[model samples]
Target: MGDDLPPDLARLRVLETWAAHYLTRIRARIAAVERQQAQQQTPAPTAAPPSRPGTGPGRARTPDWGLAEAGIGVPTTEIHRGDCWARGKTLVPVSAERARAELADGTQPCAVCRPDRVLNRLGSS
Candidate 1:
């Protein structure tokens, strides 16, 4: 009223300042979303499916073979077939002969994919 702001007017000014700040933040967020929409990207290319006769999440497919590692300095624990979704950390690709040998040596075939059954049915190599 006379170089001194009234209490109600001061409160209104504080609220207006807060609203302006919030509006600015909301505008910035909206702009970011708009920019993202304007620059939409194509999805990454997918790899071709496995070339096996069978089809499923688990089957003879890409990778073909691999060894499931137990841990650092520990012996490899399990052998898994290609496309076995439940395989743990794969240490290396295993050959058919190696998979057969390992399974015979008690390296424990992956229970989920039943690599032993696949190997047994496939028969040597």
Candidate 2:
């Protein structure tokens, strides 16, 4: 075949072969990079065991009256600093004095923290 072909045609054939080989390698590298990027974007699976009560990661701290709120001002239930076991409730931090006043105005204390007793002690002096 090389004997039948002109030199320029032979040279062109060789260049085309080289170009095809180079393009194939480039495409493979692009695919590898895309795969890497996809792996990076995927979220890792969380295989951590469920947290144990008062002993594992993210255990609930003891509830305190350091901060108080009335469940976003609806007065349904008051909240203190720690977890209240109430769902879908928002807390608005207030001063201890304001918390006492809210308690006086019939806002129920948080069942978890018992802010009523805490405020009573605060009011005592």
Against the unseen true structure, what C-alpha lDDT does each candidate score? 0.70, 0.58
The Cα error of candidate 2 at residue 79, in Å, is 4.1
lDDT of 2 by residue, 20-119 (tens): 5565466567767877987889656779864443455564534334344433323355546444333123456566787787777877676555777767
Model 2 residue runs over 4 Å out of place are 1-75, 82-89
The TM-scores of all predictions, comma-separated, are 0.45, 0.36
Residue pairs with backbone atoms closer than 3 Å in model 1 (clashes) = none
Steric clash count of candidate 1: 0
Q: In candidate 1, what are the lDDT values of residues 10-107, reduced to their tens digit?
A: 87677666765565466567767866975796546669854454456675345787788775322348888866655543446789889989989889
Q: What is every candidate's alpha-carbon RMSD to the true fold? A: 21.0, 26.5
- Candidate 2 — which pairs collide? none
Q: What is the lDDT of residue 3 in candidate 2?
A: 75
Evaluated against the true structure, the overall lDDT of model 1 is 0.70
